[model samples]
Target: MIEVLGENFIIQQIRDFEDSQFEQTFSGIDKATSNIKNIFESLANKSCKIVRYKKFKQKILNRKPWVDHEVRDLKKTIKPKGAKLRQEPFNLELKCNFFTHAEKL
Candidate 1:
């Protein structure tokens, strides 16, 4: 096995052994690089690891129903009176009107 192409390449750094030592010459540099790549990939496959984790499921909630027509109409009526009361805080008529409409709820 060629040192720089196989698993122990980093320790040896392919020292001392000459280019003359190996009898096989690749047809081109690309083929030589591919053989080294294959050896590295095989070693990586043996050492690789996998990890998994659980995902949190958020709680789903049902939407509340909107106010019905009669209650909606009552709020519309009362809202203007309450606004007028706030503008004239000392007005007895507006205060009384707002309270009377509010109690109809």
Candidate 2:
């Protein structure tokens, strides 16, 4: 079963992070840029997830000669969106967007 409420809560957390601003600055010239690292680290620690998966032993397909950066990036972005669309098949907007992106590839 899809934990729709839990997913919505996670999405809300991401939205809140994007909506809020932090004033992370440090004193002294040498320490001026240090806070930026802390800011991003905090963001990752709070917002990102870790995944572990098992891989099957299989032969690799070599398509590097034809696939370009745009295709690679599009595939990367499409993966999670495709997963979400699967979970919420009734979401019309997401379905449309996913199909449009898939067409691009």
Candidate 3:
């Protein structure tokens, strides 16, 4: 009877150790998953910024001709009023509608 009790105690101890190890492993995996999620989020933000800059640049380039014409018209209109003619490069606002729509993911 004593030998049977000793064997049962050893079996219980081994089961407990296995359960502890499994819990530790699962916790480590959760931490790794969280870290990966953060890294991906940072990467997504960088990509969005790059795309926004590219689109802003393209729009400015497209408007070059219209901007020149508008400036010429403005100068002609203001010349009779004795106003000084001035021209400057304007920064265009690039709306991230697509990025905002996809933010849910």
* Alpha carbon lDDT of each predicted model: 0.65, 0.71, 0.45
Q: Model 2: runs farther than 4 Å from truth? A: 1-61
Task: Provide the clash count, candidate 2.
Answer: 0
**lDDT per residue (tens digit) for residues 1-105 in model 1:** 243345565334334232324436555555556656665565555556545678989889554386677777898999888888889999998888888889978
Assess the local accuracy of residue 91 in candidate 2 as a C-alpha lDDT between 0 and 100: 100
Residue-level lDDT tens digits of model 3 in 1-105:
334334554446445544543335878778656655654454455444454343443345444555677566665554433322123223221123223323422
Which pairs of residues have clashing backbones in candidate 1?
Answer: none
- The order by descending lDDT is 2, 1, 3
Predictions: Cα RMSD each: 14.3, 21.4, 22.2
lDDT of 3 at 11: 48
Q: List the residue pairs that clash in candidate 2.
A: none
Error of 1 at 88 (Å): 0.3
Model with the higher lDDT, candidate 1 or 2: 2
lDDT per residue, candidate 2, 1-105, as tens digits?
124324565456556655655555434333434444554555565566767799979988777887998999999989999999989999999999999999999
Where does candidate 3 stray beyond 4 Å? 1-24, 49-105
lDDT at position 9, candidate 3: 47
Which consecutive 10 residues in model 1 have the weakest lDDT in total? 11-20
